[model samples]
Target: MARIKPQALLIQSKKKKGSTRVSLATIITCNILVILVLLSLYATYNHFYKRPTSQLGEELMNTENTKDGGAVKKFDLPGYAIIETSKGSITVELHKDSSPEFVDKFLDLCQKGYFKGMLFHRVIKHFFIQGGDPHYLRAAEGWTLQGKSNGQLSTSLNSPKHEAFMLGTSKTKPNAKGFEIFITTAPIPELNDKLNVFGQVIKGEEIVQEIEEVDTDEHYRPKSPVEIVNITLKHEP
Candidate 1:
């Protein structure tokens, strides 16, 4: 080997050390980047797939629920009803297993054209819209039907939750006729166990939202009536 100068050796050693430091820095940076990417992926998965559905938040579902972005699960209920309204149609899935007598009576009434021309008399935003009074025909004289007594009102609290789009009977009040029905605009915990939820809006939830948003009077009655044009029943397996 040629005689190496001490200064040249020192310079060579410093260069080697600098190159090693650069490689180490590069490896550390790559590792940090990988970690950050993994964390980001996990967070996204959790947000979409593992997010809990029990809490209320800016998401209307806390009180007002919308459809889950996932596949729509089919429900095999005993009966279903398509409520044709002035604004649109709302399809309700009845839970006869939970509220047998109530469902039977409601279906009987539908078969007899009891709900036709009934006005959605009461509408409270972010709360619910009440109808099926069987006797509310104020402004909508021609479009409204005079409902007869539903006889003895009967229902069960064994049904599903009082969540948004749930079809429930009137609250338990002194001498409540029980023929008055309401659809929840949100999760109403206060009405839970105090009323009967006999059905759910499987379709046309937007119509319910539209009805709930209608202008209301001081008594929560809709200023402009939202009429139930008719109810078509479906006996499903």
Candidate 2:
């Protein structure tokens, strides 16, 4: 090339540097825009497709522990029981804090299989269903079964109400050989505190309703026997 002017060379050098700087700035801006678009896509995917960890945890906890308006109250008992009847199964959570002794005794009876094969002998429609009468299971066993009374009352804060699906001990007469139990189909406020509410039907209100609506005789005994097939305990995990 022919000799170039020094001033022209300097001007060309400055213009080349400016072009390079502009190219670098343009590249940086494009990279920043791409990163922003990727971040927005990720946020939208999480919002629509993925459930938050906190919400999932909350739902799981609710499944494990729940309270119903007309059924079982929320409780953290040591264990629960499943009463398998001819109709279906009824899951109940015992009220240990209020009636610890009664709950222990009830669990002990369940462990001994005392309730197996017993019939839901008495079922008052829209009122209650009674069972656990050994006399009905084994009349020759010399057990004296009697109707429950309201002599005993509790004042503890944890004493469960005689609401729908509440499990209460059927108080027998003095010197009775065996015990009885009843489950309310409706809120019997008169029985509140008068009867010992030891448990609540948590997951089997539908089963209870089925038993309650069954045909009964004039004596309130179920026409078709509703037998207690088994009683199983579920301990805390």
Candidate 3:
């Protein structure tokens, strides 16, 4: 073969260098894309599947440490209610600061015995235990009333953390209605400010969990009736 020219050799070297640079850049770009995809997948899993246990603990601690600080007009007293259930009793502390109206209505209903002997009509494990539907209780008594108005207690969406034992009112309007209430069995961050969070369990969390873990029908109604035997209010001076 004829001897290659110096310029030709230099040009070939430059081409080789350029090709090497392009290959390195392609490899780096591919690695970055793979890393980004993995990061995105991790984030998605964290958001939907994985419970952020540490974060939840922090939030719970914050909620526990929260004080009323005269946030709303004080109730007649500061205390909780004892909900006597067939399974056990649970004590719930009303969040009067954030949801004064809802608390007042709940207290009024409790005092009126509206929740007496009401079945925990709906319960989902790791979710919530619901009751306070007088209609359901009446229907169980074979006295179904069609179009009979259930007692309505007006409420509004309140910004309270929906953690385990937090009480939420069923919404009839966008942000109103409080005849039915549910006690969360776990952190329900999705319901924050959507449901009227009126109270939280101050005692007997195990009882709440026990009710939630009870066997239920396809409609989530408890197979063995878990009734609210009574609700007795307490006042602290």
Candidate 4:
């Protein structure tokens, strides 16, 4: 208006056009941001608010099984037995809901004082200690039989896995486990998913180590005996 130069007027026009373009871009960007926020809210609602327990259950469950899916139904197990080895004492909790038949068979043997004076017959250093075979029991003067005829056997495809408590398991052979419990010293990854770990040793891990160190000939039977004075079931609930 004040007799602006022609060049200056042209520059002013360009500046106004640039501002219009910037304003349009800002509006478009804000609209996009709003849309993203709405989509996020919708997705969250669909995933959490609208999802059912059945769906959530699948995520938390360890196995693909649903409803009597071989999962421990009781939600919790009872810590009941104490295996006091010469090295120390180990506590074990039993799972009836997960494997009541197995637990009962083991408990029956314990109640019978079957493990008294039994040697930890087999030892795989840093892997496990397997006993429970009546073969090692100091029975007056005869070989002890191991089977349902004289003793119980585990037919489970996978032994209940537990790092705390030792458990009896099989290795491809039928009725191969009797009074045998192996302690997992290292995490055996190959055994994962394929084996069922049932118990863990809460105490007396040192005993397991001590038992492992005992010099063995060939069968892993300790030259010296690792005796279980007695295994008493405590706090069944």
Candidate 5:
């Protein structure tokens, strides 16, 4: 019935346009948030849910590619094992016959990616670098069968006999062989034939000494963290 002022109409139109722009911006922001949530869900599923089963059949390869890898030989049992660390490496001789079950179990853990993110948990300058406890893994608890007998960490294995103590720590008390191996920084004359000597460091004792010489607290853990980044087992052809 009445004519509206042109100036007032222009102002009203501008306000309507500004409201439209705000609505569009809000929608765009919501969409972006939704996309981010989806991406996060996918990443979580990929990491925690999926397992890379293809590597099982591909035969172990030498990832270290050094003397550590060179000194390894194929023994009657699995021989020439390599543990490449960020700090250094320790190549061990697997005891197939003497410590058959435990040795194979240890190698099995190495076969999987179990040792990759694990660290040399306990380092007692002269005692040894005590690792192999599942607690040291990045995310341990939920993990199934990480080479440790029983679900927790075992400090001892069920070896009927004992061997040289200086070779490594077997914790022969009763039950203590989950995954802990100690490198002798200082020779202990007492442990020579009392503990089960499974394997020895054919090479890389220098790295072993470095691990042994680290300063330790009352708990015997090094003041610094030494990681065992990789492990490769070389079998005889």
Candidate 6:
């Protein structure tokens, strides 16, 4: 075997050290890149699926009350409404603090008997049941109301999420909602910020669920007519 010289040995040791350093540097870079990718993925998951409730609360708080200089109204006590339907009655607690204008308009319509004998014209399983359309009520009389008393409420809280048993108003135009309202049977996050959530079912949630189970056509109109006999509002003392 040939004996290696000291200089050649030292040069070989230096080459080994250089290769080791390069390998360590490459490993550290790869580890950093992996960590960065994991962090980005976590952020994306938090943004879409696990968004914090505080963020949702902030959005609700930031909602613009567009009632045109009308002061934010507050109820002395929580108010509730009894929705007498063909199936059964559902009681909803109005969120006056969060949606005063919506609650006010709804109560006004109820007092005016606008929803009397109105059909739950639209219903979707695991989604919602919509009613309070005067057009449908008038249609039963062989004519149409042409959207009379269908005035929209401008100041209302946008529904950030549609929780089960929540009441929401339909938005026909930007930041405007009319007499059409709905009750949710499931969590519908897609309806967030699209509809105005004004109340939540405090009693007879089962009745709302029963309504959803009703058979409907492709257009979601109930096969058997489901009518709103009347809606009565009561204030809690």
Report lDDT per candidate.
Answer: 0.71, 0.74, 0.71, 0.60, 0.58, 0.73
Task: Score candidate 6 by lDDT.
Answer: 0.73
lDDT comparing candidate 2 with the true structure: 0.74
What TM-score, over all chains together, does every model reach? 0.55, 0.56, 0.56, 0.50, 0.49, 0.56
Candidate 6 per-residue lDDT, tens place, 1-237, comes to: 999999999999999888756577889999999999999999999887786888876666566553648766322443889999998999888988788888878888888898899888877666677887655332222111111123222123343446778898865442333377778776665566456799989899889888889998766678999999998888751
Evaluation by lDDT, superior candidate among 1 and 3: 1
lDDT of 4: 0.60
RMSD of each: 17.6, 12.8, 20.2, 16.6, 18.0, 19.8
In the predicted model 2, the residue pairs found to clash are none
Over 42-132, each residue of candidate 1 has an lDDT whose tens digit, in order, gives: 9999887776665323343223323687544333333899999999999999987788767877887788888888888877666677788
Instruction: Give lDDT tens digits, candidate 2, residues 1-237.
Output: 899999999999999988756577889999999999999999999976698888876665455434465454433435788999999999998877788878878888888999999988888765678897756433312211222233222233342387778898744342355767888876665565346788899998999999989998766778999999999988641
Lowest lDDT sum, 10 consecutive residues, model 5, at: 139-148
Give the least accurate 10-residue stretch of model 4, judged by summed lDDT.
139-148
CA-RMSD of model 4: 16.6
